[model samples]
Target: MTNFDQLHRFIFNQANVRGEIARLDDSLQHIVHSYEYPVQIQQLLSEMAAATCLLAAILKFKGEIGLQIQGQGALKYAVVNATDDHTLRGVARWDEDLPSLPESFAELMEKGVLVITITPEDGERYQGMVALDKPTLAECIEGYFAQSEQLATKVILRTDLSEPERAKAAGVLLQVMPTKASNTDVAQDTGFEHLCKLTETLSSEELFSLPVEDILYRLYHQEEVEMFEPATIQFACTCSRTRSAEALRNVDKAELLQIVEEEGAVKMNCQYCHTEYRFDSIDVEAIHAGRFEDTATKTQ
Candidate 1:
């Protein structure tokens, strides 16, 4: 019984460390239901989605974070996006006949690169790339943090795909806060290590089942923890007919009309939500003429 689709943030008052815990149920189900992915693929995407939410919670800005895996093996690519408001959507592309899911990350995503992109609503976008040479996605993410931000980070992600109707994903992240001149290195290191040891004891079953407060109490009851109000996470797709029409406007007019003539309409499907938007010749004409509102009125 997991209370899913929630993100909790907590700070250790005794140490210069902050943590986030996130669990996804309905959001996970919505993503998996969008595609008929294998169990392994679904689990992987679930973990990524959970991780994205956790990372998004840690950000201090107003924007979205995207996590992507590009591989040369059976898993071609996987992407998860989480907005500052906690909306999530994700998709993965893979070879249909993946003989069997590879047991190790290296084998599953051979020669892959993990790319993290942050798009701020008011600032310049940032991107970081890391080689996926680690045994687990969590370790890869930790490595990225260490390399890009010079911060020691630990991440644990778990996914349960046994129940089709109750697919679950959960993850926890802990990071060392930047040290000040007054802060002692030895003290920070000891605090970080102790927190990591406590977090390492978390089992997937416990993580998938326990409430956020209970989980925190179980792990850090000895420490002074300040729990913040939890945030709701949902499966939200940023797709719209207007966006589809804008995409159509990008095509050459001749090519766009040619497709409409052949197929009777230009059909666009959102990969994230599987919603289809169709535009007949008249709609295409309105889009080109910059009179999309008129087309909408006519259709109505």
Candidate 2:
């Protein structure tokens, strides 16, 4: 069986091409079980998680990448966030019991927009958007790369939701590396085409079952490829009580007091992790007084 929750990166030694493969097993299961999501939504979330990890691994900066899809259809929104450390979290919002749902990406997401955001630790944030016009999420991602990065890119995503307990998601990304001006004739790079064709032969079963090395060997046995050490990915939520407290502190004081008076406490729940943070009258008073340390102590 493949090593679960690991991402591997590789490059063609003879061509300006790079690739990544990310496989999620336990992490996918954890995300699926975190919420009472339908099977189709679970599958979509799994694929987005895998894709986020793959995209995060390719970035040279220390930060996070996010993929979001919003539409007016039954599925209101879906989002996946992946940090440079391979930690990921995601959630989706939709109308319950969506009827007669079509499986095609565009049909399911009526008037949808796919947005890709990259926030680097020490640089300006970047965002790219594309319409959900393709039949598959993978194709839409490819469209984003084509329009934003102007690089030839291909994305393949797969999810196995037959067994809820063992749900798995896996994906591959291939992109042409920036070449020197003198070598800008990408069309003449027959090696890149050959590698892409080889990668296209990958099956979902192979992606979920075979080891990373074995899969790479099977796909590029004839080519000289350099594979990097794999990075482990995990389902992790970054929400914290301190952050929640700060959010509460930023709210209008009178309104917060009103909530405290009505409910006897102010409560906040993290959508990503479903963690609940509660603050009583004393905590709210400390927050209004700017005594954050005291509020933390009281909450503890």
Candidate 3:
């Protein structure tokens, strides 16, 4: 049996800080399957998928978050979107193949920037951009949390590819509570530094494969951590024929008709779910009517 993908939250009994660790299985699989991506892109997708899921876990609102990595270099664009439900889908855009593997995050995204956008279902959206000069994706994310949210946070991500096509991506986040004061002199109250030190000692394999309790135990055996119920993470897309039809509504009617005349029909495909929605001449007329008749109705 496969271990269920889950996100776990824990807090130090004595410290005023909180932490989260998440393992993504279904979500990772869905992302990699969305396209026939190169091995390097797959690796990047795994890391970004984990990072996005972890970011969603720390939010106190209900919305979707998009984590994007972009540059003018060969790597151009790599992005992942995760929702409050831990459902995720991601894709990458790269043109030519590189001569060699990327040695570090900097090499992959030359002069890149990390763009984070939070879109709440009911409130105004927020966006933050951070320089991607860090050596690793984790470091860039930590930098974002520090500068954008002012939270002393650390993120560690790991992805493994082996036989049987086994792929695992996991991330851990430690953040000082917003209300906590940052001070160095108070040894007893210095939980933030202590937590960071403990988390830094974690290894990639342990983070990705081992159970959450075992990993936390190894990291904080010296201190007490109160663990909470885990939230499962999965690969799910919100795309639907209804939503696709709405997109069709936005396009200029004449433009859509021109394509339909040449191609015989209008086919809309969602990159996130790899699902195609086809609109024939009749369907286009209905779209212009501001209503879509159900496929069932057409068949009838």
Candidate 3 per-residue C-alpha lDDT over 1-300 given as tens digits, one digit per residue, 9 for 90 to 100: 134478888888787778888787666787875676667778888889988988887567888999999987768898898889777888888756766657466777778999999998999999999999788899999888778877777788888766326567778888776664542323236467777877889998677666778898999999889999888788777777677777788888888888889998788777776777777777777887887865631110
lDDT of 3 at 9: 86
CA deviation > 4 Å runs, candidate 1? 180-190, 294-300
lDDT tens digits, residues 86-136, model 2?
A: 999999987787665666667667899999999999999999899988888
Error of 1 at 209 (Å): 1.7
Decoy 2 TM-score against native = 0.93
| Residue pairs in clash, model 2 | none
Of the candidates numbered 1 and 3, which has the greater lDDT value?
1
In candidate 2, clashing pairs total 0
- In lDDT terms, which candidate is top? 1
User: Where is the poorest 10-residue window by lDDT in model 1?
Assistant: 291-300
lDDT value, candidate 2, whole model: 0.83
